[model samples]
Target: MDKYPYTPGHRGIETSIAAAIDINPKLGRLQRVSEAAIRDAGTQGLTADELAAKLGQDRCSIQPRTSELKRLGIIIDSGLRRSNWTGKSAIVWIIAPMLNSGESPSQ
Candidate 1:
């Protein structure tokens, strides 16, 4: 079993969370900003690139924040995908509804 509460083979979330804990204050702020951006986006959902653009930051910089938010159960994958800046499909994310907020990873 994986020791962390993250998907097997996925290091980005784990790494981001770890780095946020010790390396950067900006990342933690970005997570909060990203959360609001995603929530304000409504059902349309924003991809990492879109959020980055809106936040006046680099896409790569904000992508990890999204991953961390997802891991924390604060946001969720919306079962939809949209074209990113590179024209490749990217998963759309939305804030987890209030009812789902209390649910744990196992639920």
Candidate 2:
């Protein structure tokens, strides 16, 4: 069984909930693609918009995967903001730094 890292909120309309459930099976693969896209951005990192553009994907499809990645500590907010398409400032997401000296980052 493939246990997902996150699930949709129950408060949405039935169709939305159903859509989320339908996408559950693919989230892991999508997360991997999103993760790699963010990682490939290197030290400059990437805004969610930049990532969606790089992946040629809808931002809505990508955001949930990013949320899961952040929960897993696979990525972090870079403390930097970049102007998005609509001129609003957006967070920069970066791959979380690896721990040194054999320390587990989550612990």
Candidate 3:
């Protein structure tokens, strides 16, 4: 028996969550939109408007969902400061690690 049943991949978290969302169409759409926003922003960061435009969504719709996604740990926020923006619009998000079954990394 192999000690490691699954080969770790760089795309693990995104791939797994995406697969889960696929079974639930509503979740799939939300994840896709959020993922695209993170991708488009890259490292420069994105405001709500920017993300909304990129995902073809209204600002109101994107903001709350993005907040929810961040809380879920599916996305990570840099929490950095913006040059001129007055709110938390400068947050940069990325797909975070997905821990293996029965395993947890030290914080």
Candidate 4:
């Protein structure tokens, strides 16, 4: 007789950790807003104000969300630099890919 073990759902510990990270209930809302902004950006990308407007959130909320997303490796910050407009620095951000095929889903 061969024995087989049952595997849990697609995500186990990761899901738990993500839930735990949301110590503040608003964190989830912020994350969703960030995700929506990223989705709206698509290949074009967006600035902080653009993201905030797209998500219907204030810059204060969007900034923290962007920081958290960057911490989670979901987004990359290109740092602030001069834009086409004078006296204005543009902070570019890029959304990272969810996963790499060769990389395992679990840590």
Candidate 4 regions exceeding 4 Å error are 1-23, 78-87, 98-107
Give the whole-model CA lDDT for all candidates, comma-separated.
0.75, 0.79, 0.52, 0.57
Highest TM-score scorer: 2
C-alpha TM-scores of all predictions: 0.71, 0.80, 0.49, 0.57
Tens digits of per-residue lDDT for model 4 on 27-104? Answer: 666676676667556656666766777777777556666666666666665454435233477676667654322332
Supply candidate 4's per-residue lDDT for 39.
Answer: 55
TM-score rank order: 2, 1, 4, 3
RMSD of 2: 2.9
**True-structure RMSD for candidate 4:** 11.2
Off by over 4 Å in 2: 1-4, 7-10, 99-107
Q: In terms of lDDT, which candidate is stronger, 1 or 2?
A: 2
Q: Residue 12, candidate 2: how far off, in angstroms?
A: 4.0
Cα RMSD, each candidate: 5.4, 2.9, 11.8, 11.2
Model 3, 6-69: lDDT tens digits are: 1111235887646434434354475567766675566655655567767787665565556655
lDDT head-to-head 2 vs 3, winner: 2
| lDDT, model 3 | 0.52
Please give me the total number of clashing residue pairs in predicted model 4: 0
Which candidate has the top score in lDDT?
2
